[model samples]
Target: MLPLPESLRPSAERLFADRLGLAERFASMLAEQGPERGLIGPREVERLWGRHILNCALMADAIDPSARTLADIGSGAGLPGVVLAIARPDLTVTLVETMQRRATWLEEVDAELGLGLEVVRARAEDLHGVRSFDVVTARAVAALDKLARWTFPLVADGGELLAMKGGSAAEEVDKAGKALAKLGGIDPRIEQYGVGEVEVPTTVVQVRRRAQGTRKGETRG
Candidate 1:
């Protein structure tokens, strides 16, 4: 199990309620998670409340107000996906995951909560159809370079890629430069945060997937 809230103090429960309004539902989901996964122990739930929920909500800073649909790849446990679904109901969130169990969990929760969402169970590459979204997001899924491949086609022209990266994201951005360019993403930028004591580092990675047939795909700084 993951660590509980990196820092749980006064006013945190309120944050949980505000940020994660459906705390009781989330707790119920967490209760079912480990047993469903068949790994049971003790992992602090508060930590997840702050680090995951609050941290995920921070992605909003990267998105354009025009964005209404978001695709969260590998949305295991629905950190950012579920959080976004609740926090921003205006967003038509698509939780794409290959794992059936996790997908079911996501689907069940969304259905139970009546949150507007579309859950797709398939490999990222296998996805087809007009699934273009305004924002494509991922957290702790793969390296940024590989992530470009994982997330590119899912984005429509003018959409953005929000990557939740760790400390020293600049190096990863450098490593992913070629990949992001190939995927028609540009103007990547980093944002730093601290979840209480733990550094909540991530990259907003504002990108405009260039229109096809354009000569210069990368958005100029």
Candidate 2:
């Protein structure tokens, strides 16, 4: 099993609980299939717990517990998608990757981890009218402007787009202002979470869609 930090153990135990076994299986998968499929760098295997798993899992704390549907776009290694599924069983997480290899790996991981997630092998733009979800997430996918363009259409009215960002979270939100508004997003804000847990808290650019009443007759952009 990958070495989890002592400080993170209790939280992991509580968050995972009955699914702890699935968590271990995921760690092993990242160390094994990850590098072989070029999902993660070879040197990253050792840092999987802190850098990948925890980094992604921390986003769970930022999401609303009541959200039922979540889509992770450009889910190369299922960073936040698979981790979120392992952390929150109530959420129906979908891993969306355009590449066949990554999508196939995600399907395999989903079945092995028994997370019961959906794997969609299509670009975000193609899924515009096909479906929508309560929450959409992406990590290191693209610049916020481009990300907004790609994902904003997939968010259901009254739902949210939670993009896991870094130091540039605020800047990206600023840059994405026009695109976000054009995509029917409102109330864009940067929220920093995981304080006291990870040295640097995870920063998320949370953008909420207009209320259904306000978005009447609005179609995907």
Q: Top model by TM-score, which number? A: 2
TM-score of every prediction relative to native: 0.80, 0.93
lDDT of 2 at 136: 97
Off by over 4 Å in 2: 215-221
Q: Candidate 2 — which pairs collide?
A: none
* Model 1 spans with C-alpha error above 4 angstroms: 1-20, 31-41, 128-130, 193-203, 212-221
Residue 49 lDDT in candidate 2 = 77
Q: Give per-residue CA lDDT, model 1, range 156-186, as digits (tens).
A: 8777888887765778889989888877786
Q: Go through the candidates in order and give each one's C-alpha lDDT.
A: 0.70, 0.86
| Weakest ten-residue segment in model 1 by summed lDDT | 6-15
lDDT of 1: 0.70
Report residue 138 deviation for candidate 2 (angstroms): 0.3
